[model samples]
Target: MWNIMKYVCAEGIVYRGLCGHRYADKRRSVRLWVGGPFTHQIHAVHNSVPFSQTHVVTSPPWRVLFFGTDSFAEESLKHLFASSCCRQKAGSAVVKLLEVVTLPKDLPVRRFALQNQLRVHDWPNVNVQDRFDVGVVVSFGCLLREDLICQFPYGILNIHPSLLPRWRGPAPVFHTVLHGDSVSGVTVMQIRPKRFDVGPILNQCIYPVPENATAEELGETLATMGAKLLIDTLQNLPECVANRREQPSNGVTSAPKISTSMSWIVWEEHTCDQIDRLFRAIGSRIPLRTLWMGEPIKLLDFVGKFHTSLSGAEAETPGTVRYDRESDSLLVSCKDGRVAFRAVMLKKRLSALDFYNGYLHPFFLKKLPRQQKKCVFGSYKTKESDTPLGREAAHKVQNV
Candidate 1:
């Protein structure tokens, strides 16, 4: 999904194409969550709208409008129009707002076309005079035909969240979360016909995703970031029009549109680091795996990057339980060495100290000789006649 990048406290014209993502080559195989993956485009447009009281008429800041489906995008535009923030303080100065007209039902191939890209014949409310000074398209799911591009005095600019040419698809943020990339950014570019995310760059910004972000969270966060970038560029449109800088050709990577199959978690072929990245990038949309007893558990969160050599135990394998249930930390074995879990997810909820205490089985207790009390979490007070097992799991850890 595209997020609009903007400059606060600046004047400019910005157009919004609240379009959804439609597959260029394989429509039958693609699927996505509505208002996600590609829905951030709408969010970028909605949030970046100037909340000032400027009179937006002829020769005003810059004229902007939206075109989209009758469903989500159209309704979203209506909500924006109704917002008090968009209205000027003086009732006399109305911003040049336009009602979203639905796509035409009369045109051939109307059903297959993106709601915004249907032939004008397909637009029931097509007015030949519906022209604009500039266009900013965030999550338009349809391909913009040449006629639409020619309608604007300035070309249409799009907000793509990935650093263009890589992850150039409908779900860059989703893929970034799933893949666990350390950095993901937003891009603003010219909307070239038929080419997806290959336009000349206007501007781009990248941000870091920590090891715990889920897909839903990353998508919303990126949308907010991207929208700001778009608005900032719009404020400086005069400079951009005077001097259009061509995008560099070197680091291009395409994020192809994703599907439900792409969302499935692969337990094998995934390193702990790889798995960690995917979970953070995808966010909560993709669940993490854990087993309680014999049933699989959906983990809300867990700690990774464990060190086996730190355990000081030659006999313990990676993921092996140095389970200290009393302290709420589990020493699980990793591929290379042993790592400890101070916290874990049992269902959707995260367990602090008591969670680990509840899972303590007697067999898990027999594995350690009771000397591994590193104070993971909880009360530091020790009983006078403490056994080896009690000592190991009784130390206190600061809850972070």
Candidate 2:
């Protein structure tokens, strides 16, 4: 009887009685579930068919319009194009990359599409004459309007860097690393209008953020993970069609676009940990600028710590740089703690020692002044008239 009911359900009668009214109420979703709110059970049951019946694709390949303009999105497209499921076979709803909606011609994504012989249409100049099954957007650089999103059978799908409802906007990768999060991941979700990333998540994949991993490294790692996850989710698209749940209400956070202001390391204002994170998050994205020997220098790498040597004492002038012969690193002062500038760039990239020897040492004395309660930044006070370093020392004194 169970086998008979399963066949009856497969024939579609069981759901008509149980879900017909609900399906009518939600016109957006074509397939209504058998178990109502518990969507995955029956669908996953069918999707678990024997490998011998692999040819049996329950639905035809969805007509997918890809919208993206970056390497991250390109990675997802590569998987989508190369997957065996995307081959020209007789499976129902197997994905077909009908066309791409990308930025102008010179961009990497557009060039990739053209090289692959895929049709490229500018976003606002969307070719809507032919209907589309679904739209997949990944870092497309702009939001789609409601009418544009509504044209597809299903609305847009976004491949986001961080898990949705957390890190819910652009530059999620930066914020995740900035906050020193232990774990971060990618989310493929419905792209809603007015707000970005506020949609039902189709799937998610998580990976750990190892200590000291830069934002660029983490983003690339997540992009690869996201691509594989998106492919698997698409392969099981039929099961996932009606299975999405709304984003959880709690634990929401925004990852706004990275700004130039975020690139500055405010040693006097920020703790060592915070300044270290700032450099790590935006180091690759933008140059971290700071005063080295009172001359503006771009920071390449930094190391932060509680400064156990200054256990009972405190950092006197936060931006003051000190020489640590033990590590061959340039230690700088931060509020409550200390940090090291491992690498920096002025006209060219160089290690802290190289910068110190060529520029900083030439300007200031070899030894920083000895102190008792707090680390003192005293050097290059030639006379009553102040040089650049002297002026900086004077400013530090006033701040203290």
Candidate 3:
């Protein structure tokens, strides 16, 4: 008797259901359960055996637990529910067909953290002595204890957003984008009771990061790839579980958690390549904040290309504002070269053109008191200035 269960915690409520197997032709997913309204609907359509009706000699064939935060977890549950449609659709429908679960604006990160605990590892009386088939962890921020890991005879598989053996810590995407890695991909590792992303790589999906990929952009892309990778790895779990491997104790790089201080644009210490990576890594989602001319300016969008235009004596000082105007790009100098920026954010407002225009005057004259060259494309300033440059920049935006 196999009863596949899907568990999810949302809005202080817990949703659990039996997984359905009819979705796949391979029968690899003996049963797939998704914990949400959409999953419930899919269960109905797929005719999944009701948990009450089954008289099983043994436990369910497979039970998958999705450990995620409020919106992140709930949305993933909806995605699992929607995965039934993936077999029928061509190309990667996995990316486009996710069910959006919106959370309130005031939702605290603390509450979100609690929700994940309740949904994934908070099974009241579950005994680890009785082993389960497999456990797949995707984007769930907490560490799994040995008790939970032992319960899954098949072992726990985690979808980390970096190539294993590298960036094996909390913030892989940020490090990858900030450091400018030509290749970025996901690694499915066997989870062990350890500090952070230290585990044996069982499977992996590799991809390249574009020159202009930002952290937010790369994160979303990696998240989607992670979802698919989880499914693929889970389908092959029987084999992956059979061959257990431990992570190499040596040659491990730590990707420590991020802080606001770490994210602030440090124009002086970074290099041209580092700044280029930062511009791409910060992406549109998480606007990279920097103190520009004593006022905080959040970069909304930007472009980096080889520059031959500004090659003179001023190249000695990188991060110097070489050109700032209504033009689509603002050029800045670096130790070796320069880069141009376009999209930007002023205060909390997100607009590329407005941000450029607002800082154009001060940037041109190097009148920004707080401005200091950290690298080619980075300058620091705090958010306190009466300069009408922001207002004028806001008013001067011509096209989107």
Candidate 4:
């Protein structure tokens, strides 16, 4: 049995339309679906909105309202535009892209959308008209109001980075890397008003995290996967929405956004596996910051392997910086292990040993008159919260 969809007007009015013949608007034509893959234009209620131009026959593809302000959104939009639903059998555009609602500060997404001749809107509360059939949002920062979304017959769809109820929030991709999750996936689901990511799921696809894939690498993979998943779901929007399944709220987890304060690595606190995973999360930006010789040191690159005899440092001694001149590599101490590193951000992507000896050691080491035994490299702190980032600290949301 086909499911009946309802729509509410701007004036808090509720109305329902039958499956066959209806008038969309007096000024335009309404295309109503009689059965599978068949449609006809007829005069119906003035409230009904036309999906396509009335003069031409056949059901026009959905008029999609895109909400995204990042690369992820760009990928999905590209797929939709290149897909058959967006294009007609004759090579003409079947679906129309309404204005894109994006973040004010996101220039790249806006630029891409405008380049395709699509209108872009940046205000938080986008003034949504009733003409759109469906709204598609991916990586959009703001929350859409329920009143605005109610105007459409087909509800809004959101493409999320992680599986629902597992990593739900703004930073699923980041958390997936930080936590060393072997499995990562994309979720295409309906958006619940005000809530972050709790909604009924329409489709999902999972993939393994590569051996040492950074957050950016994993995100790139998911971006492509999610784009395809979203387009496929949209192609069968009616059935998918009718068969939608709610996300299990029992295992709900929040992947709060990342912050600078969460980048401090506590050398003694985290184990070798944890430290290596964090380096992967760093990807190509926001290298971990920690104190060395009472001065700040930035960790640019880290290797997955642990070094014991290579560093000549005893096991369990964390925060010891060692330089292997032969290999041109650097080792930083971690709990029960030493993690190999390549560079520090202050200098070029060269050996950290060079950075320490040439500049950091000369200026920073002299300040410490006495070389204390069992000294932790990251012990210096300007404030108490500067402490190393732990599992709890990593996920902790500050001032949201």
Off by over 4 Å in 2: 1-60, 84-93, 292-295, 303-315, 346-400
**Candidates ranked by lDDT, best first?**
4, 2, 3, 1
* TM-score of candidate 4 to 2 decimals: 0.77
Every model's TM-score: 0.53, 0.72, 0.58, 0.77
Clashing pairs in 4: 22-44, 23-43, 23-44, 24-48
Give residue 294's error in model 1 in angstroms. 10
Candidate 4 has its poorest 10 consecutive residues by lDDT at: 1-10
Pairs of residues clashing in candidate 2:
59-92, 59-93, 60-92, 60-93, 60-94, 61-93, 61-94
**Backbone clashes in model 4:** 4
lDDT of 4: 0.67
Give residue 398's error in model 3 in angstroms: 34
Query: lDDT score, residue 147, model 1?
Result: 63
Local lDDT at 282 for model 4: 63
Report the number of backbone clashes for model 3: 24
Error of 4 at 238 (Å): 0.4
> Mind giving the per-residue lDDT tens digits that candidate 1 earns over 225-332?
766666566657645433444556776555666542333223223456665665565435545443333233344445665543454655543334555444455555
What Cα-based lDDT does every candidate model obtain? 0.48, 0.65, 0.52, 0.67
Instruction: Count backbone overlaps in model 2.
Output: 7
- What is the per-residue lDDT of model 2 for residues 247-347, given as tens digits with 9 covering 90 to 100? 89899999999976566565657787787778788877787666444445676666656354853336266666666667777777767677776777766
Q: 139-196, model 4: which lDDT tens digit per residue? A: 9888888776655556688999898889888999989999988898999887778787
